[model samples]
Target: MSYHNPVLLQESVDALAIKKDGVYVDVTFGGGGHSKEILKRLGGNGKLFGFDQDPDAQGNVIDDERFVLIPENFRYISRFLRFYDVRKIDGVLADLGVSSHQFDEADRGFSTRFDGDLDMRMNQKSKTSAKEIINDYSEEKLAEILFLYGELRNSRNIAKTIVGKREEEKIETSLQLRKVLQRHLPKAKEHKIIAQIFQAIRIEVNEELDVLKEFLEQIPNLLNEEGRLSVISYHSLEDRLVKRFIRTGLFSGEPVKDIFGNSNVPLQKVGKLIVPTPQEIKINNRARSAKLRIATIKH
Candidate 1:
């Protein structure tokens, strides 16, 4: 599993409060790292289902009868698990954001440091790509994605530059895009700005935020009474959704109150936020921004 080094490995799994004989899931089963650890804690009767959309992950599938790797996105977690007669789960783990392997493979076009094609589709079969977004999307649409997803304030200027540059020659590679936005990238902040731009395009191409919302919406129904949810998010956008859902059971705004003035929240936050320790961050730089949150079925 050099494909990925699961962040918050022990802390995230411990958040599951794993039951020896209960069923569980690792929704982001990259490299099967977390799933393997879950199996180690499971008894003979325990079952663990893994979900991953990337075909590359199939290579790392566990050979245990107790483990089943579903070759689909976790947005369809409930539907796929039901195909196997599983209606409830004791715990579920999610390590959000792109896998280390995806970032390392230059051809996949995930890294800002690499000069590769503009393709950034997490599911290879998906049609949309960074190339399409950069070269085909309207200037307004491009600006919107950069502003919202990338958290960039000068997105309109960047979008205009991209459109102007592509008119002469199609922006086909990461370096080409970088050159198009040269004025925007100051030497001191070049890496941070480019990362934000890449993140913006990747999120839009993969519909990551939408998929996350859909997957989380099913958690209330998929979990058994007191079932645990352990999630590790690398960025603020994803973490906000998880935190809001766990607190209010809704992605936005306050929860509605019933006749008795009791809010109908479904999941209860289990503990304070968990971030990578200095020791862990030193060992794995990817863990630097990782934030782990745990929740369980609300009483």
Candidate 2:
């Protein structure tokens, strides 16, 4: 089966403005779609390092001296790059969120459509899983996760139901857990609401927001002068961070200034945010929510 079709492919690549011999990094190399494109624009000496936490992503790796696939999380991208003996790079591209392959694989339990194990860990090596969140977390913590991460309006009731049901039998599978929390869901909007709740749980399980912050903080140290960053965030939460970081060099708050009024920051915005054209979204509805932000280190 084909790996995921990279969302906003041309838009993302073009934003990078690839140099003939520049080094680049694809922080989330789901199926190598963007990595392959980066390689195509490179000269013989150019190199591309790709990172993916999921082992399943490696199955799509291409055999090329120009490409190096790292089966690790992008949160430690700087460490891995340094270990690989790459000190600085020309650009970085991050397409965040779960891949289509993960969702399609029902056993992974990332989607609401399937009844499977409640394991949403992107990297199986990781100890924390969705099952732990649902089973081990206290009622208060569970409600917080659903409300903060999932944005479920009835988070309190859902958490209450989960805690109430798990006492009788552990919520082992997605179906079992969903059935228990069914009461909190609106009858007419069950499907979409359930999906949002699941999304929240998966975000907490993966610690995605925290990982993203760490990764973004390292970008200034990772890039050479004028090095570009092209990030495609799938939801508002992720997009807000990316936008804020690019604009102010901090996840929140205004950019800091020196006594003399000079800004103290490493990155500068390139252009207004980009979203998918209607045609692209029509073909792949998943692309609809994607927001692409581009920036470059201070030259």
Candidate 3:
């Protein structure tokens, strides 16, 4: 039931500007680290709702009168909250991407270091998996995910190799897929290359980017006046979306200007982007790529 220490626990909660009597949410309630901290700062009337789609995360649910864990994905934040009669919240916190516990568990196939099944669904109920994506996706489609999600430069070649190898033998496991793309893994760049490959498949399996966009689109309507949003993303793709959504209120393209030169955006950036200090990165290597962004409803 132990999950890695929630990234930016203190910094993210502090950014929420928690009101003792406020209602809040921890959307990625892995191990309940961030939710627990927010609970400590809340008054008797305060409430904290947690959401996690991973069935395994249910084991880490906290026992408290003020907390309720929603056994669902954060993308359904608005729908589930409505079931609780919660229309608007004071703050929402999301520690994006895979949890450390998921990466550490070899069977999850989230880490490149482990040799395991090609199943990378964050939710166990998910029908699509990394194995299916690698073994069934067309070369063109595979390349698209690798280039977009993995940010791999040689994505087309990597996809061609996967399609070629899977034709000979189905790529069933992590090591098997790695072997299929052996030529791409140069000695000096072995770790990075394999990681990118895995990342691309995992993102596809989970439809991560799509889920993120859906969740963010609901934030403005879900938050109360002055409500805060704190998100910690480990990759540029997620960070870029969060950054753009905060600044422009759209994932792509610029906001249209009105006759008065005013652009109507739903959210505003709270402050400068935040990243882990070198000291923190030394303690938790997972925090190395982490970037924190905060935002609030435009008023």
My TM-score estimates for the predictions, one after another, are 0.99, 0.97, 0.98
Whole-model lDDT, model 1: 0.94
Model 2 Cα lDDT, one tens digit per residue, 102-221: 988888989888888999999999999999999999999999988988788788988998899899988988999788877777799888789889989999999999999999999998
RMSD of each: 0.7, 1.2, 1.0
Among these predictions, the greatest lDDT belongs to: 1
> In angstroms, how far off is 118's CA in candidate 2?
0.3
Q: Give the Cα error of residue 181 in candidate 3, in Å.
A: 1.2
Writing each residue's lDDT as its tens digit, candidate 3 over 1-299 gives 25867777799999999999999999999888999999999999999999999988999989999999999989999999999999999999999988889999999888888899989999999899898899888999999999998999999999999988888989888888878888899999999889888888888898899999999999999999999999999988999999999999999999999999999999998988889989888888889999999999998
- The digit string of per-residue lDDT tens for model 1 on 61-169 reads 9999999999998999989998999999999999999999999999999998899999998899998989999999999999999999999999999999999999999
lDDT of 2 at 171: 90
Query: Which residue pairs overlap in candidate 2's backbone?
Result: none
Ranking by lDDT: 1, 3, 2
- Compute the lDDT for candidate 2: 0.90
Which candidate number has the best TM-score?
Answer: 1
